[model samples]
Target: MIRFERVSVRYEGTERPTLSGVDLTVPEGELVLLVGPSGVGKSTLLGTVSGLVPHFTGGLLSGRVTVGGRDTRTHKPRELADLVGTVGQDPLAHFVTDTVEDELAYGMESLGLAPDVMRRRVEETLDLLGLAELRDRPIATLSGGQRQRVAIGSVLTPHPKVLVLDEPTSALDPAAAEEVLAVLQRLVHDLGTTVLMAEHRLERVVQYADQVVLLPAPGAPPVMGPPAEVMRVSPVRPPVAELGLLAGWDPLPLSVRDARRGAGGLRERLADASPPEAASVPEPAAPPEASAMPGAPAPVVAARPRTGRFARLLGRGAVARAAPVADPVTRVDGLGVRRGRVEALRRVTLTVAPGETVALMGRNGAGKSTLLGALVGMIEPTAGSVRVGGLAPARTDPRAMVRRVGLVPQEPRDLLYADTVAAECAAADRDAGAAEGTCRALVSELLPGVGDDTHPRDLSEGQRLALALALVLTGRPPLLLLDEPTRGLDYAAKARLVGVLRGLAAEGHAIVLATHDVELAAELAHRVVILADGEVVADGPTGRVVVSSPAFAPQTAKILAPQEWLTVSQVRGALEAGA
Candidate 1:
C-alpha cells in the first residue's frame, strides 16, 4: 500500500541528503517494522508516507512516494488524513484537546465523520487500547504511558487504511505494550490495515513484524526482507536473536517460544551452572588525611565512589564509591499523595540506601510518576513524611533540593528550553555550579557526536532524553529518579546508559527509576517494586520479582526460567566460563 520509488530527501542547509535513493514497497494488510540507529532518518522516512516531508518539514523531495496509490507529493497531510494516520514520538504535541475522550474524537471530527460513527469508533478504540478508565481524565493529568495510548487511540479512531507509528510502545509497560501490539496485529490480520512502525525497543515488537526494514546508516539504502533474514546481519538485534547467534542456531528465533523450543540442550547445559555474579558493590574508599599545615585545621576531603561491574570491565571508570551502603539516601514513611479526586500514591513507604538501584514498576497510571515527582519536590504529599538527604523535599529550597535529588521526567522536553544543545548544556553547568563542560561531557557520554548547534526540538526522542538526563546529572544529586527513561533508546544507547548508571551507583548515588523496560530493570536494578491502584503490590530483589511475573520477565529470563537467568550476557558468561 505504501511505495517509495527512487526517493531521496535533503533538508535545507545540509550538504547531503538524509535519505538517498530509497526504493521500497510495503504491501497492504502487512505489518512492517522500520529499524535503524538513532537519527538515521527513520522518522523522515515515515513522514514521507504521510505527506509531511517536503510539505510541512521543509525538505526537498525527489522521486515518487505513494500511499494507497495516492502520490504524497500531490496530497498534503490534511488531504490524506482519511488514508493515513500518523502518531509521532511525542504524544503531547499531537493533542488538540485537553481530555482523553475529546482527543480521541478530535481526529474524526476533523474528518467530518458522522457523530454516531465517531462515537462508536471512540468507544472501540478506548476498549482496544485499555483506555476506558482514562477516557474522562484530562490529557494534562495523564501519565506518559497513558498519553501514548491516547495518542494511538486518537489516530486509530480515524480508521485509516494506513497507520504509521513512531515508538508506539516505548512509553508503555510490558503488558500495555502487548495490548497495543495485539491491537495492531488485529488491524493487520482482520481489517487489512497497513501498519508501519519504528521502535527502539525491538525485543517488544520484533516478533510481531511481518517484515523488517533495516536502515544501516544515514543516506544508505535500506534493506528489507523477512524479519530473520534482516536480523542476521543487522547491527541492532533483540536479545533472543543475539542468543540465537551465540548458540549457532540454523535460523534465529524471533520469539521466546521459538527460542525455548530449541533451547532444551542449552538449558540442560546451564542447569548445573550458576548464573554470573551480579555487579559487586565496592567497599568505601578511605577518607583523605587531614591537611598537615600548622595551625590550619585539617581540611577534610571526600573519598571517591566506585563504578559498576560493566563500567570496570569496559575500562570506562564511569562510576565511583561515594558513601557507606548502610546510609539511607532517601526515606519515605506512610507517604500519601492526592491529585484532584485521585489518590495517586497511598501510604507508600520505601527506602533507598546509598549505592542501591531500585526500580518502580506498574501499569499505566499506577503512581510511579507521581512518586518520582514527590521525591523531586514536583508533587507535594497529602499525608505522611518523605525525606531525601535528610531534608523534606516539599519544604526544601530549589537550590538545596537539586543537590539532594534530581528527576528526569518521562517527557524529556519539559526539562529543556534552550534554543540549541550547546546553550542548554552551558546553562545546565551554570545552574548546577558544575565545571564549565560538565553537562557537555555527560551528553557526549550518553549521546556521542551530536552537533552542539542542533536545536533540542529537532533531536530524536532518545537524543532529547539523553540531553535531559545530562542536564540533571550535572547537579550530581545524591538520589536520582528517572520516569520511563528508556522510552526511545536503542540497545547500543541503553548499554551505554547502563554503564553510566552503574558507575553512578558505585559512586554511592542512590537511584529510583520508574520504568516499563523490564530488560533494563533486570540488568540495572538491585530491587523491583511493583505498584497497582496506588499501592505497592510486590517488592523484592530483582531476580525474584521479575522471574516470578511473566509480564515483567526479560526475554532471556523467559527462555531459561527455572534457572533464574535474566540476560543473554549471563548465559554467555556461564558458557564461556564452562568452556
Candidate 2:
C-alpha cells in the first residue's frame, strides 16, 4: 500500500538528515512496525504515508513516496484523509471535538460523506473500538488509552485503507494498550487494513507485528524482515529476544509464553544429550551446617520464589520495622482543586505514612494528577489543606518543601538541561546543598551501561526514566513522587525501575505516584489508592486494593502469585519454587 524510493528527508537543522536514502515498501494488508531508539525519524517515516511529511512538517524531501499507487507529494493530509488515517503520540493534541461521538464523526463530516453513510460508519467504529459504552462521554473524561482509541476511531470512520499510528500506546497501561492492539489486529484480519505503527516498547507489540522495519541511527540505513529474524539481530531488543540469542535458538521468541516454551525445550534437550560423569575416588566435601535452615531442606534452591528486586529493595528494611511517627508524612483533609473553570479534585482525603509506597491509579482526568499536584503544592487546594512532613505543603518554603519531598514529572525531559548525565546529577546535588555523588551510585545501579559522557537526550526512553529517577533521588528527600514513570519502558527497564523504587522505600523514603498501570502497582507499591471523579474510592495494601477493586483489578496470575512479581525474573523465581 505504501512505497518509499530513495526517500531522504532532512529538516532545516544544523547538519544531518533525519532519514537518509530510505528505500522501502509496505505491502497491502500488512502490519509493519517501525522501531528504533527515540528521535531516530520513525515518526517522520509514518508522516510520509499520511502526507504530513512534506505538507504539515516543512522539510527537504529528496525522494518519492507513493501510497495506493498515488504519489503522496500530490496529496496533502486533508486530501489523503480518505486513503490514510494518522494518529499521533498525544491523542489530546490532535482532538478536534469535545465529545466522543462528535470526534468520531468529525473526520467523516470533513470528507463530506452523506449523513446515512456517516451514521453507519460512526456506529461501526464505536462498536469496533469498544467505545459504545462511552459513546456520549466527553473526550476530556476518557482515559489515556480510551482517548487514543477514540482518536483512531475518528480517523478510521473515513474508511481509510492505510492506518498510521505514531506511539499510540506510549502513555497507556498494559491492559489498555492490549485492548488497542487487539482492535488493530481485528482491523487487519476483518477489514484488510494496512497498519504502520512506530513505538519504543517493542516487547508489547512485537508479537503482533506481521513484518518489522528497523531504522538505525541517523546517517545509517534501514533494515526490514520478519519479526523474529529482525529482532534476533536488532541492536535494541527485549530481554526475551536477547536471552533466546544467548541460548543459540533459531527464530527468537517475542513474548514470555514463547520464551518459556523455548526455554523448556532447551532444558529438555540438555538433559537428554548430557551423560552423567563417573564417580571419583576422592574425599567428600564437608556439608556446612551454617548453610542449612533448621527443620528445612537447605532453603530448596528450586523453591526460591521469584521476587522483584525493586519490591525487595523497597520492602526489605521496613518489613520488620514498626511505625515510629505519629502523624503521616502527607495528609489531605477535604482537598479540592480546580483547573480553569472545572473542579479536578473534590473533597478528597488521604494520608500516607513515613515509610509507605502509595500508587494512585485512575483514568485520565479522573483527578489523580490533580490530587498529587495539591499534595505537592503545585496546585493550591480550593477548600482543604495538604500537609507534608508535619508542615502544610502550600505554606512551606520552596527549599524546605523540596528537602522533604521530591517529584518526578511525567515528562522528565521538561526538567533536564545539562549536557551530560553526570553534570545533570551534579547540578541537582549542588542545588540541594547535599553531599557530592550522593545519587551517583544509585544512578549507576539503575542504568548500568550509561556513562558520564553520555548525553541524556541520546539515551533511550528507559534510560531517560532512570536518569530522572536518579535526579529525584539526589535530594534524598523524606518523600518521593513519580507520575507514570514506566510509560514507555519495556519489561526489563520496568523491572529495574521497580527495584529502584523499592530500594527508596526501604530507605524510609515515602513515595506516592499517580499512574494507570495496575500490574506495576501490584508489584512495586505497598499500597494502592484508586481515584474516581477526584475522590479516593479505594485505598489499602497494594495486592488487596488492586486485586479486589472493581476499577483497578489486575490479571489472575499476578493476583494469585502475589510476591508482587513485576518482571520475568520475579515470575521465573516464583515458578521454580512452586510458590
Candidate 3:
C-alpha cells in the first residue's frame, strides 16, 4: 500500500535531512509502528505516506514515494486524500470545524461525496470511534482525547484505505489513550484498514503493533522487521522487554499480561534465590540533568515560606495548637463545572494535602483535566467551591493564587514565549521572587544541554516540555499541578521529570498531576484518583489504585518489584539487592 525507495527528505534551512536513504514498504491492512527518539524523523516519514512531506511541509526530496501505486510527489494532499488519512500529534491543529458532526462531515464534503453517503459514513465513524454520544458536541468543548477521536473520525469518513497517525495518543491520559488504540485495533481487525503510526509512549502501543519500523537517528540507517525481531536488536526498549532480556525469556514480553505469564515460571526460581541484605543495596541515583546542553541557565531557587499561611488562616498558628492532622492544603466540596451544555464536573469532592503527590487519572472524557483546572482557578466551578490555601479559588486574588498554585498545562508551548531559555527562566524568577542562580541550576539539572541562548520554541517537543516544567517550578508554588507532563517525552526525559516530581513531593509541595502515564503515576504519585465518566470511581494510594484498575493494572512493574523503584536505577538496585 505504501513504498519509499531510497527516499531522502531534507527540510529547507536545515543542514541535515530528517530522513535519508530510507527504504520502507507496507503491505495492505498491516499495522506498522514507527519507533524512534525525538527529532529522529519518525513524523517526517509518516508525512511522506500522507503526501505532507514535500507537498505541505516543503523540503528537498530525492527518490520516490508511492501510495497505492501513485507517486506521492505528483499527487497533492487533496489528491491523495482518497488513499491517505493523516492525524497529527496535536488534535486541535487538525480541527477546522467547530462542532464534532461538522468536523466529521468536513472531509466528506470536500471530497464531494453524496449527501446520503456522507451522512451514513459520519454515523458509522461516530459509532466506530465511540463518538456517538459526543456527535453533536462542539469540538472546542471536547477534551484532548475526545478531540483526537474526532480527528480520526474526520479522516476515516473519507473511507481511505490507509490511515496514518503521528503520536495520536501522546496527549491522552492512559485510559483515554487506550480507547484510541482500541479503535485502531478495531480498524485493523474489523475494517481491514492499513494503519501506520508513530508514538513516543511505546509502553502503550507497542504491545498491539503487528510490525515495528525502527528509524535511525539523524546519522544512522533505518531498520524494519517483525515486532519481536525489531525489539531484540533495538537499542531502546520498554521496561518489560528489558526485564525479559535480564530474565532470558525467549520471545520477550511487551505488555504486562505477557510479562506476568512469562514471569510465572521465573517467579519460582526467583523465590528460591536468597534475598540480599537491604543495607548492601545502593540508594537510588539522582535524576538526569534537564537541559539538553551543559552550562545552560540553572533553574531558579524556590524560597520556602517560613509559615504556612493556610495553617495560620485555619487557626493552627500557635505551637500549642499544632496537632497531628491530615495535611489538607486544598479542599473541594460539591464542585460542579460545565463546558457549554456538557457538565464536566458535577458534585465533585476531593482534598489535596501538603507533602502529598496525587495523580488524577481517567478515560479521555472523564473530566480529569477539568477538575485540575477548577483547583487552580483556571475555570470557575459553577455550583460548588474550590479552596486553595484556606481561601476560595473564586475569591482569592489572582496573583496570590498564582504564587501558591503553579500549573504545567498539557500544551507546553502555551506557557513559553521567550526567545531563549535564560529569558524564560528570568521572567519566571521575576514573577515568582525565585533566586536567579537557583533557577539556572535547576534548569541545568532538569534539562541539560539547553543553553541560555537556545530558543524555547525551536527546541524539540521533549525539550519544550521540560522548559515548561522548569518555568512552573521556578515559582515554587506550594501546590503544583501538572497536566500530562510526560505526553511526548522519551525515556530519559521522562525519568528526569519523574525525579523532579518526587523531589518536589518530598519537599512538601502538594503536587496534583492529571496524566495518562500509569508508570509515571506509580513512580511519583503517592495517591491516585481514578475518574470514570466524570466521577471519581477510585481514590487511594498509588499501589492500590494502580493494581486495582483494570485499565492501569496491565502496567504494574512498580508494584511487583520489591524496592521503591521509579526508574531503571531503582529496578537495578532491587535486582542487586536480590529482591
The lDDT leader among the candidates is 1
Worst 10 residues of 2 by lDDT: 296-305
Q: How would you encode candidate 3's per-residue C-alpha lDDT over 1-579 as one tens digit per residue?
A: 889899998866566777889877887887899887666777778888888888887888889999899899999888999889999877887889899999999998998999999999999888877889898788877888788889988998998899999878876766667778888898888878999998878888899999999975763568888887888887667777777777788888887777777776555545544332111111132224312221122221111112566654533311110011243667676678877777787756566666778788878878888888888888888887788887776667888798889888887899989888888888888988877765677778777756698777546666687888888898889899988888777766788787887778777788899988877776677667777656555565565456655676534343244422333344445467665
Flag regions of model 3 displaced more than 4 Å: 12-15, 173-176, 189-192, 269-327, 339-341, 419-423, 435-460, 557-572
Cα TM-score of candidate 3:
0.84
Full-model lDDT for every candidate = 0.86, 0.72, 0.75
Clashing pairs in 1: 305-320, 305-321, 305-322, 306-320, 306-321, 307-319, 319-503, 320-506, 320-507, 322-507
TM-score (C-alpha) between model 1 and the true structure:
0.91
Candidate 3 residue-pair clash tally: 28
* Order of candidate numbers by TM-score, starting with the best: 1, 3, 2
522 in model 1: Cα distance from truth in Å?
A: 0.8
lDDT of 2 by residue, 174-241 (tens): 55677789988988988899999987767668889999998867546799999998886676675566
lDDT of 2 at 180: 84
- What CA RMSD would you report for each candidate? 9.5, 11.2, 10.1
Which candidate model has the greater TM-score, 1 or 3? 1
TM-score of each: 0.91, 0.70, 0.84
Best-performing candidate as measured by TM-score: 1
Better of 1 and 3 by lDDT: 1
Worst 10 residues of 3 by lDDT: 316-325
